[model samples]
Target: MTWTCTECEFAANEDGQDACVACGSERPEEEQETAAEAAENGDDSAPEVVVIELPAKEKLGVKLMPPKDGVIDHGLAIDNINNPLLENKVQAGDLIVAIGGQNVDGMGFSGAIDLIRKMPRPLAISFEIDEVRRQEVVREKFQQNKDNDLDTQLTTYAVVFDNGPMGLNLEEAVRYGIDGAVVRALKGQAKTSGMISIGDIVYKVNETDVLCMPYLEVMNVLRNATAPKTLQFVPKEKLADVQRVNSRHSESFRLRESTSHVKQKLMNNPRLVKDDGNEGDDTQSIAQLIMDNKASPNVTAEYLLELRVDDRRMVMACTSESDKK
Candidate 1:
């Protein structure tokens, strides 16, 4: 039997233990009574926290916003394309309850960051996985795609690819948002087969639905599956409808609530503009001049295409001399 510490919220401590192992905080009196009552009533649905160990050497590759006013809240890390948190099966809005067994209940934004920075290698971080966030994200994506014409429904198709040179570019088959494995380009035998085409999203491999699986896990499933593999795919445009139907079938996948003010506040962050240094500033500044019969400026569309020799050379150099091709 185990009980959660109220001070640190560490739930892994044994019942006999007088204090929390993580933060060394004593168990709360209310928690002790609740645990006793739960045991007496045979309550088996007690909460269990999930924790993950991450090495300090690797960057988390995530953008985190500090909780305002030292309020400990969930969903500090924002999810975006290629975010490591998403790769680890964590949704956009998950809690960072503790770092290295220390609870971050009142830790200010800077304090949390400092703790994470100073923590030892392979730090244990407890996360309270929130499925509501996942549902909201998927539902938002589904709503965006609702504008697609549903009158002409596109159905999924299957193609069997033999062993050797399957012709699918496995590298580009990585997960992109909720679109699953998008078919970027098809060549060789895959192109020869009229059944599959570019822009088709992989729905399943060997009749197993991998739409929600991690990209690497999906890849492993493909690599380990038996040959003469039947690949199921749907037109890229119809993925949303399929997801909607799936959500309808399973309540867990369905959207439970709309986006909240807290989530919106967290999402509203300043964007960073990248600066490509002015290497050819002088040459690009020299624009070709054109004048009408009156000698006034005549900036026509054709005239805008024209540039001085040096400017043209600079532009070509900027494009790695690809303009000649």
Candidate 2:
């Protein structure tokens, strides 16, 4: 029996040589059969790409990151739409593994862009959500547990006794119509699987039912509670929704405005200011301030705060400038 490696197409005719002679790869079980079938039928055309029923890729509105070191596993998630990711699902930190069945890994920034653009629009975009999102979804489902009656039952979490607080903050979980305290921010070291998470609408704490309760009262319940507390919650948004929300913040460079543009913008920048009670120059005179920042290479908040006595006019660095010298 003749065997061929799919990757390097190396022929391994020897009985003991189980791997490819050229690439040193173990041959796939179907590689020989597939090759033989193709040869017998004389069909060398590539397989057609599969089209999945999903939202249009463009309207779905995702921004793919430039491939790094010659590969793109996913793109950064941006929340163009609100908490309804089911409408068009994708999340932050998800790698674009494939588009229209083309494996794009290792195909650096330009390669990925070119391939996607050339491929058909509304192309099937495959992605892997980040680990944080995966855990958040699982915890959300577990917390929103319902019976045949569909009542959300309380879920318990084993609290790891760390110096940190309950890993999550609260907000109004009104969008989903569940009147519970929503999880806002999950603190560092508190973000873990099997614990509370961001976007979880926590409704219970210990014996106290916190749903429909004030924020402070709920906090009090959690603050006084001991370890191994039972805290029930449904996610403020679904897993799909949070993944999109979590994915929305994109990292990109901001263009530096021209010096004249900077001077003009200082009108609202709040960084540059006029002298207190001694209106010597118009607010437009802040052109000098911009020049000052340019003049001193080491100009910083500290340097600006060290105000100099210029004709008895009091200047400020920032919000703390209300104090008169």
Candidate 3:
């Protein structure tokens, strides 16, 4: 029989073992009995393997570390905001010891993987985490990042990227108090400066908490924030362990039934073809186009362009669908 330390999850031989060699913690009484029963059962299962795919578009959201010392530490090192493992109540740094009632505590990396692949679903995992260690990490983060004026003052100068100026593309989500506009797109400078990232929910601009704020008022705040302005943002990914999109979409080649059909669609879209609206073409050539063409700052047109760029992907999706059809 094997014994394990509840604190560090270190395993030991024999039912009488009292302390863990790794952390010197007292072993739980029930652990030894469980191992003894497992030793008798002698690990037998059918060879055929059944693979269960997780929910679509939702990432498992785990970064696996390679085994060291021939032992698989099936531990969650870092947690992605929408990680399914976390939504399953698995915490960062938790060591997985069993899957589907099968003990895999002593297994090597490959052995553990094999066990997981062979186990039937819905998967029931048993794991342990060093609560003391986890707490220390959290406390350290709070002290370093949040000890100062994180709430009252924001830190970032949204610089201009080669692509454009710094500011998130936004959409209106009235339920979230984002009646004016919601940040949906972020330029390179904002992300590089650590001011914002993709999928951030903007709450306040310069600490005004712009709920029910007029659209013009919101724009005024942003325009007024010349340099070194801070906008409060919340990362949307952390809200759920696994984020399931309400609808999943993609330009699948299979959907066209043949490569030729895929080619036909691309050929059909004028924008997709070279020389159709090629940037290399001069302004004069663009002006001569059959379609309505205009150049240089039309204030009204520029504002509309800004709105489109704010949700560039949405615009692209619409354009793509329109072109394909």
Candidate 4:
């Protein structure tokens, strides 16, 4: 009995067959006849497309504030804020304010840092202050720039925690308060300028916590707040390890998901075409296919467990890899 794949239109050979000769699509003889009859009668079914939706739940937020004109009472000293090279003129004890937001006018804290670097200064007088105070001063400078020019550039900081200088340990860094984090795990002399990361928490700026908030909210607070804010939070000790593991797991999950989708597509639409004389057949267990196309080395056992319930091929690959030499 001869048969043809309903999908690729590949026909069976002279010998009685159960699958298409060109593509490894299997079909019972009776089913093939039924499908052929239906096709003769113009009956057809639309192909189904599968869409995988993976939900990402991680969140981070940064807030911008207006500049405040306050004397350097304590903490970081004025000498610290003065960057003649960058032409930053704000000195210790100088009054400044924060500014900028999602829709506000002016640059926020991050932009001020760039200004400092671009115009580095020596012996510039700002009052002595700590890290947290310095952050506030920078925020204020950003606001000042905005007030002076409606076209002032805007910048924000990002908080990130990762491995420290030592292997397997972690550190934290606050980038521009919205672009980076304070890496405190590394050992070095305290920096007079540039990024600061002594311990876990930011020593400068107000006590208004912006961690995990939406990016827009952070911008809104800084742009609209009339007073100085304080943000407080303990640093995560194992943040680096956690992030590394999460990143690896996410990628593995995505790849396995993609492979499963491909397999299902081929199974449902087993259609092969004979363009030339050569036959084309593609068939493999999911495990074999994924191993051949392993996306990363960080895929964990836990990630595999999550895949087992929905992806049989992934489970098979896990078991198969363990049994190998």
- The candidate scoring highest on lDDT is 1
* lDDT by residue (tens digit), candidate 4, 159-221: 322322211112222221211233444432223223334444322224454333333444554
Q: Tens digits of per-residue lDDT for model 3 on 165-252? A: 6646765533232234455776556656665665555556665655335456677777776455566655554322101110111121
Candidate 3 is scored at a TM of 0.25
lDDT values for all models: 0.59, 0.49, 0.46, 0.35
How well does candidate 1 score on lDDT at residue 33? 86
Q: Which candidate is the best by TM-score?
A: 1
Off by over 4 Å in 3: 1-61, 73-81, 139-325
Better of 1 and 4 by TM-score: 1
> Which pairs of residues have clashing backbones in candidate 1?
none
Ranking, TM-score, top scorer first: 1, 3, 2, 4
How many backbone clashes are present in model 3? 7
Candidate 2's C-alpha runs over 4 A off are 1-148, 152-164, 174-176, 194-196, 237-325
Compared to the true structure, candidate 2 yields what TM-score? 0.24
